[model samples]
Target chain A: MVDENVSFEDNLKELEEIVEKLEKGDVPLDNAIEEFKKAMDLVKACDDKLKDAQDTIAKIVNENGEIVDFDVE
Target chain B: MVEDYITVSKVTDYIIELFRSDSNLKHVLIKGELSNVKLYPSGHLYFTLKDEESQIKGVMFGAKYKLKSKPKSGTKVLIKGKIEVYKNYGNYQLYADEILKDGIGDLHRKFEELKEKLNKEGLFEQDHKKKIPKFPKRIGVVTAANGAAIRDIITTIKRRWPLCEVMLFPSLVQGERAGENIVRQIKRSENFNLDTLIVGRGGGSIEDLWAFNEEIVARAIYMCNTPVISAVGHEIDFTIADFVADLRAPTPTAAAELAVPQFKEIRNDVDQFNSRANLAINKTLNENMARLDNIVSKKLFTSPGEIYAPKEMQLDLTVNRLVHSSKSLIMKNQNRLDLAKSSSVFKNPGSIIKAKKENYLLQFSKLELLNPLNTLKRGYTLAKSEGKVISSSKDLKSGDELEVEFNDGNVNTKVI
Candidate 1:
C-alpha cells in the first residue's frame, strides 16, 4: 500500500525504480499505465507527508530508567 | 592619622604595579590540580588551582587561550602565566596564557593512548562503522537529562524531520561515575532498536567531557548495533567515543541532521520520479499509437480490395477461360450438327425413304411370286382329299370329298 506506514525512503526508492523501468520503455503498455499511476500516488503520499509533518514531542529517560514525554518550554 | 589614610583603590593599584615589575611573577609556572572550573559564555575560564596545602584563583582569557580541550575540575595541570590583579575585585590571580597536563594520567595523554590502542585494535576501522540510516524513524540520544545537547538534538531532529521519533537515554555526562553511566545507557539503548544513537553533551571543559573519553564508553559505542554519532564538547574536541563511533558530529544538532533525511528533499525526489514515469508511459503510449497509425495508413488496410486484387484477376481469367471454352464447345457441337444436316440423307429424307420403300416393295413382290397362294389367285385351285393334293385325275376317286382352296374362297366338292 502506498500509505503512511511505508517508510518515506522505501516509497521514494520504489518510485525511483519504477521511473527507471518505465524510462527504459520496454514495459508493455498496460503495465506502463499501471506503474505510472502508482508513481503518481507515491508522489502525492510523499508530498502529503512533507506538508503534514508536525513537531515530534521528544521522550526522555527518567532517573528511574523509564521513558516519558519531554516537554520543552 | 586622617592624612595618612590612603584610598583602597590607590593601594590596590600600587600592589598591581609591584607584581607587574617582579620578574618572577611575570612568567611564573604553577603546578596544581584544577578545581571549581567554569567556562563563562564570554569564553573566559575561571578556576581554582589547589595543591595539598594551599589554593590560588586563576583566570584564562578566552581570546589568548584557545584550547582543543579546556581544563576542567580535578585535571592536574601546569599553567604558565603572569600574576594579575582584578580591578573590580582587587584580588591578585594567575592570568594563564598556557596550560598543559602536569604529567601521567593526563586526560589528553590518556585520550591519545586510547585512540592509538583502539586504532591498532582496528576498532576505529572504517569497515567497522555502520551506515547511519537514511530515514531513521527512531533516534536515541544519550546525554544529560537537562542540557543544551539534548535540547539541540531533539529540536534539530524535530524541526528537520518530524516524522522521526526522538528518545533520550539520559545519563551523567561528567564527573567520576559519568563513564559507567554512559556505558549503561548505551547498553540499554540497544533494547530500544534505535536506528541511530546520538551519544553526546554540550561543549564543556575536557574533564566535564571526560566520560566520552572513557575506554568503557568507547567500547560500548563500538559494540553498539545502532549507528552511534559522537557529539562531545566543541568542534575542536575529538573524544575516544568519536573515534569508536560510527560517525562524529561536531555538535549534537549535527548528529540529528546526519541521522535522517530532510522531508523536502525526499518530496522532491518523489516528484521527479512521478514526472519521469509519466513521461515514459506517455512516450510508450505515443510510440504505440504511432505504430498503430503507421499500420492503419498501410495499403492493406486503406484499400482492403488491394489484398485480393491478384486473386480477383485470377478468378476473372479462370471464368473467361471457362466461358470461352464452353462457347467453343457449343460451336463445335453446332458445327457437327450443321455438317450432319448438310449431308444428302438429312437434306432429302423423303426421297431416301421412298427409295427404301421401293426396294422393300420389290422384295415384297419377289417374295409374293414364291407364294402358292398367288397360283390360287390366278384361278388355279388347290385340291386335296383327306389333306392330300390331287395331281392327276386318276388320283381323284369318284365320290371322294375334297376341299378346293381358291384365292379368296374355299369350295368343298366331290369329283364328277
Candidate 2:
C-alpha cells in the first residue's frame, strides 16, 4: 500500500517535476502515461494533505536541551 | 679635544648619520611577540615588539606596511630594520622596513576578527545571500585565465550542460594583490549578466589561498548581487569568502555543475510530456466515439420515427375501414329504398286507385243484378205515384198520370 501521509511539499514537488517532464516531451508513451498517473495521484495526495487543519508550529529541543518553537523566519 | 657639551641639533644629526651608515644595525633581525598594534589614519603602522625581558617601540611607514600582509597583535614575527632616535622627544624607536610572521601564526585570531566584523555588518545574514539560479544562461568565471581551475570548470560545464555560455574575467589568484584584483574582476563580471560567479584557483597551501581568506575579498563576495560559488583551495580548506558566498563548492568542477542544468535530462523529460499528452487526447477521442457508436446501435435509434409512425398507420387503416363500411351501409339502405319503392301501394298509387274503382264498379254491377234496375233493363217496368210504386190498381187515383224508366232511355205514358 502507498503511504497516505506523504508530505504536501514532497507531493507537490513530485507533481511539478512530472509536469515539467511532460511539458518537455522526453519520456516514452508508456512511461509518460505511468508518470501522468503518478502525477495525478500526487496531486490528490497534496490536496488531501492541505484539506486537514494545519498545525501552526512545531517544537523541537535545541543543542542546549531547551524546547523551542521552530521559527520560520 | 672633547667638547663636553654637544648641541641638540648636532646630537640628532650624529644619531641620524649613525643609523643611516651603520650596516650591522641596518639589517638586524629581532624576534618578539607583537603587541599594541595600531594602524594610523595615515596608513602607517605602529606596534611594540616584546620579549620575556623588555619591549621595544617600532614604527613601519605606510609605504612599507602596505606591502606586507596583515599581521595581528599577539602574533610572533621577525623584523629586519635599523634602530633610530627621534630628537624631538629624545626617544629611541625601531623604524622597521620589513616584517614577516615567524612561528605558528595568528590565523585563527585574524579569522575571528574578520568574522566578527563582517557578522556585525550583517554580511553572513540569510537576507544578504543571493539565490543560485536553477537554470543559468551564462556563467562568469573569476580566476586565473590559464589556470587549471578554469579548465576544470569548462570541462564540467560542458559535460553537464553544453548550452550554457561560460565567460571568464581573469585575475591574479594567488599573491599579495590577489584579493583586490579578484574583487575587481568580480565587479567587472557583473556587467556580463552572469547567473552565477565561480571565483577560485586550484588547490594550494594556506598562504597561497590567503587572498581568498582576506576580509576585502569576503566583503566583495558578500556585496555582489549575483550568486557566488566559491571554490578556493582543496576540499579540506575553507575561507571567509566561502562562508560569505551564496554557495560553497568543494572544487571548481563542482561549482560549474551547480551553475547550469543538464540539457539531456531536460530534453528527455520534454519528450515524455508530449507522449503523455498525446495518449490522453487519443483516449478521450476514442471514448467519445465509442459512446456515439453505442447510442447509434440502440433499438430506439435503429427504428427512427417509430413512435409516431404506428399511430399514423393505425389511423389510416381505421379511416379506410370506416369508409368501406359506411359506403356499404349507404348502398344497402338505398337498395332497401328501391325495394320499398317497387312494392304495390308504394310503386303506383294511381293503379291502386284504378283497381279500387273497378272493384266499386263490380260491386255496383252485383247490386244491379240483384235490383229492379236490372229488371227494368230487361224490359220489366214498375210504376209509382209519388214516392211509392203501386203494386195494385186500387191505389191509383182517377185523374193521376204514371211514369216508367229504362236504363238507356226514359219513357212516360198516361193511364186512362
Shift in Å, residue B48, candidate 1: 5.9
Question: What proportion of true contacts does candidate 2 retain?
Answer: 0.02
Per-residue CA lDDT of model 1 for B79-184, tens digit only, reads 9998878878899899988887776357678888888998999999999999988988789999988888888888888777888888988899989999999999
Model 2 Cα lDDT, one tens digit per residue, B15-38? 878777878766778989889998
TM-scores for candidates 1 onward, in order = 0.69, 0.44
Which ten-residue region of model 2 chain B has the weakest summed lDDT? Answer: B63-72
Q: A1-73 in candidate 2: lDDT tens per residue?
A: 2266654435555666777776665566567768777876665554453343232222222324353543322
Which ranges of candidate 1 are over 4 A from the true structure?
A1-6, A63-65, B1-24, B33-77, B84-93, B99-105, B315-416
By DockQ, the best candidate is 1
Per-residue lDDT for A59 in model 2? 29
The candidate that wins on TM-score is 1
Clashes of each: 0, 13
TM-score of chain B of 1: 0.65
